[model samples]
Target: MGMSYRRYLYGERVYGCSKCKTHLATIHSMISRAFNGQHGRAYLFESVVNIVEGEPCDRPMTTGNHTVRDIYCIKCNTTLGWKYDKAYEVSQRYKEGKFILERNLLVDVQ
Candidate 1:
């Protein structure tokens, strides 16, 4: 028999809009930071998430007037994750360490 090649799709398992999927990397990073004791320390690179063709936001998403170094998805307009200046604040106040790795995000997975 000829070589049977199996196509293996190696990428984010996006169940929602493409924009949300695109920010998987950033989300993962934020989760990692939180796990590592870096809380509320999100960085948003691009401007605030914009309303894309497929994705629409009920209300404008704001970074709480905080400038970060992370990028948001254009499709879903979800605040995937962020690296904020108030890392200490998050570490102290926020009950959760990371935002992306929160239980809510994994509701479908479970």
Candidate 2:
């Protein structure tokens, strides 16, 4: 079954990652998707819990759909997420200035 984002949004707490347990983003900050990002799929997220490290580079991302910097877990070097240094879509513009984490990608501990 798919994860219930709504529960995490209303529930007391949430956590991240099965391997490292790094405190990632929250459900409250989640922005629902509308067809973009990886594989032309719609991606969603907002702020993170503990700050992570981003390795910015010139390489284009998601089929040059975005100018991106890869984010990693400071402690374990696991790829926590990324940020859009620049975006090609207006719908993506709001997130362009923010970090999009994969808390949902990880195992939610709440």
Candidate 3:
């Protein structure tokens, strides 16, 4: 046999896309963000497909006015995460072109 497709675990096993079941990312994919009042700390990412970026916003948060973008599932248009454009203020500086996917946004499939 060959390598079989992998599945993610929640209450049950999942394949991908809560709406479309399209395999996007893997279990190891990590999305971390700060100062989100709703989620409190960091978001999670099972898979990411689409990214919609707009003009820069001037909100003072992580790194102060980090350019924000919208990440979505390419198959079903589910909003998954947001990408930061610049990393001038961050000490790590690796987050300049990274995203933060919400854990709640993902759905488990079989």
Candidate 4:
């Protein structure tokens, strides 16, 4: 059976992966609820996993020093999106507050 996202919205904290039965964390937007409406729930986020056996980046760093949070699927280990600290700073500058929205979390229910 598919995961019940609706249930997660209603205070169901522990989300066990249907396939692997691993507990998943519930991440929500730190800003307005508008993101919630767009995501059809109260939050849009994921977990991050270490990429093992991956080649090191050879590209030069041009974006400056910034911390990023990556969202991933706890069960399938799917990467959702990266939330940069700079992004939050920019949003705050526009009075948008602090919030991370993962575009991949939006379901195309059509």
Model 1 TM-score, 2 decimals: 0.26
Question: Each model's TM-score?
Answer: 0.26, 0.62, 0.56, 0.31
Query: What is the Cα-based lDDT of residue 54 in candidate 4?
Result: 22
Candidate models: Cα lDDT each:
0.29, 0.57, 0.52, 0.34
- Put the candidates in lDDT order, highest first: 2, 3, 4, 1
Query: What is the per-residue lDDT of model 4 for residues 2-110, given as tens digits with 9 covering 90 to 100?
Result: 6533223323343333344333333332333344322344333343222111222222123333354444444455543334333224433332112233433433211
Candidate 2, 1-110: lDDT as tens digits: 65423212224556565476655656676676543543344345666555455666554544446777876665566765676677776665675756655534466665
lDDT of 3: 0.52
Q: Write the per-residue lDDT of candidate 3 for residues 1-110, one digit (tens) a residue.
A: 65444333343333355566655454455554343523444444434433334455544564455566666565456765566666557583566666665555555555
Query: What lDDT score goes with residue 61 in model 4?
Result: 20
- What value does the lDDT take at residue 100 in candidate 4? 39
Error of 1 at 94 (Å): 19
Best lDDT goes to which candidate? 2
lDDT of 1 by residue, 1-110 (tens): 56433222223431222333332332323223223212333332222222222222222123223223332344444544433333324433342222322222221110
C-alpha displacement of 76 in model 4, angstroms?
1.8
Off by over 4 Å in 2: 1-13, 33-43, 58-64, 103-105
Q: For model 4, what is the alpha-carbon lDDT of residue 1?
A: 71
Cα misplacement distance, residue 30 of candidate 3 (Å): 2.1
- Lowest summed lDDT across 10 adjacent residues in model 4 is found at 51-60
The list of candidate 4 runs beyond 4 A from truth reads 1-7, 11-65, 85-99, 108-110
